[model samples]
Target: MKKVLIVGGVAGGASTATRLRRLNENLEIVLLEKGQHVSFANCGLPYHISGVIENRESLLVQTPEKLKKRFNIDVRINSEVISVDSSNKKVVIRNNGEEYTETFDYLVLAPGAKPLVPPIEGIHGNNIYTLRNVTDLDKIMEKLKEKSIKDAIVIGGGFIGIEAAENLQEKGVNTTIIEAAPSILVPFDSEISNLLEVELMSNGVNLLTNNKVIKFEEKNERVVISLENGNKVEGDMVILAIGVTPDTNFLKNSGINLGERGHILVNDSLETNIKDIYALGDAILVKHFVTGQDVSIALAGPANRQGRIVADNIMKKGKTYKGSFGTSVIKVFSLTGASTGLNERSIKVLGKKYEKMYLHPNDHANYYPGATPISIKLLYEKESKKVLGAQAVGVKGADKFIDVIATVLKFRGTIEDLSELDLAYAPPYSSAKSPVNMSGFIGENIEDNLVEQIFVENLKDFDKDKNIILDVREEFEVVVGQFEHSINIPLGQLRERYNELPKDKEIWAYCAVGLRGYIAYRFLTSLGYKVKNIAGGFKSKLKI
Candidate 1:
């Protein structure tokens, strides 16, 4: 009988063991973990912090006894794999200070990752914690239950940082985020960062960007963070969600190929350089679905999928794993932000020819009681018009937009194809032309040059006098605001008073959103006037 030993028992390891057992009853499967709990709901840890999840036991997916009894798989907790002997196919498993060797025909490594703990003075203070697993959750809960945590300072603005800040706010704690980068959510473009900042600030969460902590000092039950910018901030508790690094230090000299930062290098089938040895999840690097380069993406969704793939390939099913898009969605209180495939930064780094369009569309029909506007930015190949990526933020239905784009990206769908898709629609749920279809429809127009376009963010550098910047909103609507030196010509009066505007100069039109501006652009372009409409019109000021 073939023996399979899996190290680490989170999304990847547990999945591999359970799937392996289901595929072959005769196979010997051993699952070991270095932590007290295995197969817990890690992603739900943040919700539990705010008492949204309520019960701690609900987070536990399975116990060692349950896993073994249900699947007949040998399970061990607090068993750390100290070393790997690839030549002999053996591993040193240490448990309770006892060392033992386990032999295996195949080995899978899902050591996962730990939050990066920088070496700062007083960082080991009792109040500072990093959330990663069930153990970390209990420690945090203990402090919260004992009334030890009051004001919180979360370092970093990535996924964990943002989630922690939001949940802390839910508990009525004064929380502030210290982001080292110029913006939070570095993986996304400025649009998402802009929206996230608004969401956080409006909800009374203080945010400080471009600030790095140089040192930490413990002072009378409070922690002080010294910033490189010569500022100091104090908090009753500090949570470091800076980021994660692969928990694979033991494998450094194990002859397994690792990337520059200690990421295990694996192939399409999730196999390492050593034969009969595989690695998946947060510790290993896999091919990017679109970029065709190796990247370490640490999302539970991809990790779970990787676990299933490893199980199939180990069973000799001849199945190959495709890459991941890193598609993700996060709810920041009431607002939601999501993105799929490559962002602007990734596209620029890859040096590809791409064009981007920004549009603001209502999530549902305007007549609906609770229709909300969504800000969407779509990126595509300049020549082929292939949709590269998309990002959306709104109070509702934002995740749906990104999810649709991600599905289309799996097949390299083009702008025309996306526009032609027949989506379900209703007055309450969506308009006849859904936001997703509207993006594609707008993209088709931009590609065909049916309407010339310029984006609002470029207005800072644009010469107002050189071009006629026309605000096509009704004259009364201009009372709220309008670009300086822009002429007001309502859409209804545009055709009747066309001669009042200068035809010799270039003209840019804008409205509440892009719809009215687009209508004006079509009208003026047919009359043979040099006219373009702002992609996202005057109402997009909120995003900026």
Candidate 2:
């Protein structure tokens, strides 16, 4: 029987072992986990620390005993793979004080990732924590129990940092998030991030942007964070959620090829450079489906998929990895934020030509009492009209909208496909047309030359020039607010007052939402006038 050895036993490794056993019942599978728990919910660590998950045993998805009894797989805990000799197909395993070599015909490397602990002075001192594994969570829980952690400082404004801040605040801890970047959740567009900032701040969580944590200072049994901007923050405990890197140091001399960032290099089949060796999960570099470039994505969804693919390939099945969409979602207070495919910032980095559209629509029918507006941004290739990516942020159903867009991206669906999607809708659940469909409607119009538009970023360039900025809302709507140098001409009276608009220069049209502006754009464009509809209309202006 062929022996299959899997290193690490969380999402990637455990899933691979279980699937491998199910595929080849006679194969000898040995799973090694350096930690105590083999299969546990690592993502729920923050919640556990906040006492939301009252029972620590709730995090354990599966125990070694359960796996061994059910799948007949040998799961060894507290066992570490110190070294790998791929030439001889042997791995040096360390258990207790003894060392042994295990030879395998096929090896799967899923060592996962380690928290990036910077070389800051006093970083190793007590009260500083890095949340990566079960042990880290245990340490945090112990610390919280010992001290009244009123002030908590979280470094990094990524998903983990935001979640940690929210959970800590739920426990009545005064949480502060410090990010070196200018904004939180850099994966999101700045406008959506602005909404997140407001929400986080309103929840009593202090957000410090463009601030760097230089080092830690131990003072009076508390840790003080020293910042680059000459600001010091004292916290009862510090959580470093900066980022993570692939755990590949154990393979430095194992004749394995590593990518630029020390991630294992694997092909579409998850096969490494060495023969009969495979690498999956955060430790491997996979292709970005949109850009067709190799990138490292540390996400559980991709990791789980990679594990299944590896199992299929191991069983002589012709399963191929189609690359990752980098789809991700997170909850912050009341808002649910999610993104898929690519964003405007990523497009800029890749130097790709694309067009973007923004739409603000209720998550469900407006008549439904709890319905909230969902702000969606869609980016598509201008020439092909292909859906490249999308982002949505709102209180309810944000993830669902992003999910639809992600599915469209997977099938390489065009903007026209979005409008034609026959999605189920009802009064309490959704409108006649979903927000995703509305985005497609707007995108198709832009692609078909039916609507000429300008984005918020391009507003400054056009603002300096002499142009007729027309606000198509009602007089009362403008009474509440309007942009500078804008002429208010309600859409109801636009046809009657057609002669009032200047015909020499271009006229930029806007309304409360984008629907009215689109109507006005169609009207003015047909009338032999240079007209451009402002994407997202006045609602976008308010956000900016």
Candidate 3:
């Protein structure tokens, strides 16, 4: 039997080991983890801070003894792989203050990633913490138990940062998020992430965007963070949820190809530069599904899938991993935001000619109790009409639409494919024309030249002299808000008021949430007047 040595144990390593055993029970497998626990739910670590996941023991999904009994594989905790000797197929591991050598016929490196704690002044203070595993969660939980632990400063506004802030608020701590980027949740466009920001502010989580922490000082037993703008924030505890880096330091001199950021570069078969050596998980570079560029997605779903593919390749089954779309979702206090594939920022960087459409539709039938509007944005190639990506935000069902779009992205489907999907529908669950279908209908309108729409970002560049901003929403809706210098011509009265509008100047129309503006666009276009509907309308324009 060929001995296989696997380093690390989590979504990637743990799944690969179990699948390998199931595929071929004759192989000898050894799993090594630097940490004490194996296969723990790292994603649920933030929830435990608020007692949302009350039982701490539940996070540990597997044990060494269990894996030994089930798969007859050797499991070693507290065993850290310090270096790889690929020429001899041996690894140097440090455990219990001792080092040992392990030989393998096939070596797999799945050492995931570590929290990136930047070097800032006073960062090593006891109150500053970075959560990556159960050990990190324990340290944070201990800090939260202090009676005077009232304020927490989360240093980033990515997924982990926002999740930590929401959970910290739930634990009765006044949480503040400090983001260096212009907006939080950079994966979603500003329009979608703005909804999450609103939810966070409404729940008393302070957000500081376009700011960076220059230094950290310990003052009065609290962490004092000095910002680039000369503002100072004091918090009983600080969480450095900035990001993560690939944990491949051990393989730096191992003759295996590594990316500039230290990510293991593997072929589609997941094999490294050296023969019989493989790498997977968050520590490896993967091709992006949309752009086809090597990128670091660092998502658990893709890691788990890559593990299975790597296992099959090792078994000579020859499976290939296409790529990752970076599909992910986040829960704020009361709202959820989800996205898949590329966003506008990325598309522009690639210089791809793309079109975006937005729709604000009720998640379910309006007559159904508790129905709420969901903002959906879809991006597609202008000529091919191929669905590039999608984002959704709402009190509920945001993940559903993104999941559908992600599946479509996997198959490289088009906007028309989204509209034709036979989705299940019930009054309380979804409308007859689901939000996903609505996006497809809107896309068809754009493709057929039945409608021309402009996004909220385009308003600043519109020529005020030659363009008229028309508000087609009902008169009462203006109380919420309207564009400056925009004239009110409700969709109902657009026909009668047509003579009042200029035929030479372009009409830029808007409504509360775009449906009425779309109607106005169609009515005005038929009369041979140049018109453009404000995509997503006034609602999307608010608070941005």
Best by lDDT: 3
TM-score of each: 0.97, 0.96, 0.98
lDDT of each: 0.88, 0.88, 0.92
- Tell me how far the alpha carbon of residue 55 in candidate 2 is from the true structure, in angstroms, after superposition: 1.9
Stronger candidate by TM-score (1 vs 3) = 3
Please give me the total number of clashing residue pairs in predicted model 2: 0
Ranking by TM-score: 3, 1, 2
Q: How many clashes (backbone N, Cα, C below 3 Å) per candidate?
A: 0, 0, 0
Task: Give RMSD to native, each candidate.
Answer: 1.5, 1.7, 1.2
Off by over 4 Å in 3: 462-464, 542-544
What lDDT score is found at residue 334 in candidate 1?
90
Q: How accurate locally is residue 87 in candidate 1, as Cα lDDT from 0 to 100?
A: 86
Candidate order, lDDT descending: 3, 2, 1
